[model samples]
Target: MPVREDKRGQERVWETRGSLPEPMLPLPFTVRKTRKETHDTYTLELQSESRPGGLAFAAGQFNMLYAFGVGEVPVSISGDPAAPEVLVHTVRAVGPVTRAISGVKPGDMLGVRGPFGTRWPLEDALGSDVVVVAGGIGLAPLRPALYQLFRRRRDYKRVALLYGARSPRDILYRRELGRWDKRPGVDVHVTVDHATEGWGGNEGVVTALIPKVEFDPAATVVMVCGPEIMMRFTVIEFQKRGVPSEKIYISMERNMQCGIGFCGHCQLGPYFVCKDGPVFRFGTIETFFGRREM
Candidate 1:
């Protein structure tokens, strides 16, 4: 049994002996395949031994991915959560944990905790225009949103995606990006900061793509993720378009030790990024935006 302190400061047993978090909704999944998207980016596809039962989630939620001994990290569920048996995660090899994840084989075991976090406002964007801006590996978190919109292509009016990478070789999800470009009612634009000889796309910051998007400021939802500097500039671009800050959502990245709220490593101002959000409407954090170190 585990004891917890209540608001009255009295200890209470929160669980009975030998009981564990409702049997942990375990699904036996195996890595179907792994694809290297970039030098450091990899996509892992996990398939259930059989079709999973009733696994569903909103567009922007994430999962805590566990690799045997390397520990766990909260990664956006890149696949359609509705098809829970076929889960996918796109990860960048930025640290030891990620490297370990990359080394996992087809038969390896991985644990998934949840489809956590408040999702992107998919329902609110119905019949409205949407602009998705991503930079570098930041695009991983937006994959689900893209899938949801495309899955129900008739629900929305127009959708545009603008993604920026550091170099031509750094682009992630090239295949899917190409597919999205060909889809009806969806426009996908890709750019790189430093172009190589073979590169023919736009060669500038992602903010440069903002002017090309067509949307009504009052009826649009802008979802952005990337490095802090990229997000700062993207928000400014949205402001220039007269979009309300409240209508723009941004995913914030931080060091989250415990996927749950127990550990405070992911705290930002009055909220915990791991709990209150990894995604937040710009206006909700507007006061503390760009002031973390100041």
Candidate 2:
């Protein structure tokens, strides 16, 4: 049995290679649904052909989506954890692999290799006020965490979501946001960097919406996912609000060539983003975060 040690030095037995499928081998997944979320983004709903049921994944974990000959890239699992029957990934068409992945229509086949990496610390956040902050396409990864929070809404106190997009047309889940905003005990605030006509909502960075959410700083647990600059400033804002670094978490992006840690492309300092994290408690990585050349 292979053992994996977490940042805290706790060791857990990972799967034995004999019982599980090879980690690097791609499993066939058919695209059952694909829809445009924005001008450059698409949400792909896939179902495994070889594996029955669905791919089980936790919030903030990602998959290595391969576009056949074009290659593969890391995309966060964006669907509800409870309904893993339809494996979902929100892809931004920024590179060759992503563009190919997003171009696939219904009935097309793609390769999927993982439900990998660290997950949002939702279990530890029970009974605490949960605040979710997202920027641009970063909203995709945090969507699952939001779904989990709402499913067990009674376990948490004062749940809130603050999201920022590049413009009014760039928001990822417009209909869902509207519905979440109406949920009792949940506060959903949205902002756009550049507002357009017919947009009457707030217009500013997401950090501006922080104050609008009421939470006890000491009892609040925050999850942030966005560009590095946006995450950096969001952490600063939360720090000023008195939230402890250990109580705040953030997701990171890197050139992850392998889902496992064998490939060092996703290394950040002593940790491997692909293995140790893509989600990390703020204090754990604060030393190198936002530092030049990191």
Q: Give me candidate 1's TM-score against the actual structure.
A: 0.87
lDDT of 1 by residue, 1-294 (tens): 234444422222223211113223434457878888999889998865554442355556666677776677778777775576577888888787788888778888776666555567676688888999999988988888888888877888779999999999999999889988998889899999999998989999999998887999988989998999999999998988899997898988878766566788877777667646677778887877788672
Q: Measure candidate 1: CA RMSD.
A: 6.4
Predicted structure 2: lDDT: 0.88
Q: Which ten residues in a row have the lowest lDDT in candidate 1?
A: 11-20
Instruction: Point out where model 1 deviates above 4 Å.
Output: 1-29, 48-51
Candidate 2 to truth, TM:
0.95
- Return the top candidate by TM-score: 2
- 30-83, model 2: which lDDT tens digit per residue? 999998999999999999877767877778888889998989899999999899
Every candidate's lDDT: 0.77, 0.88
Off by over 4 Å in 2: 1-20
lDDT of 1: 0.77
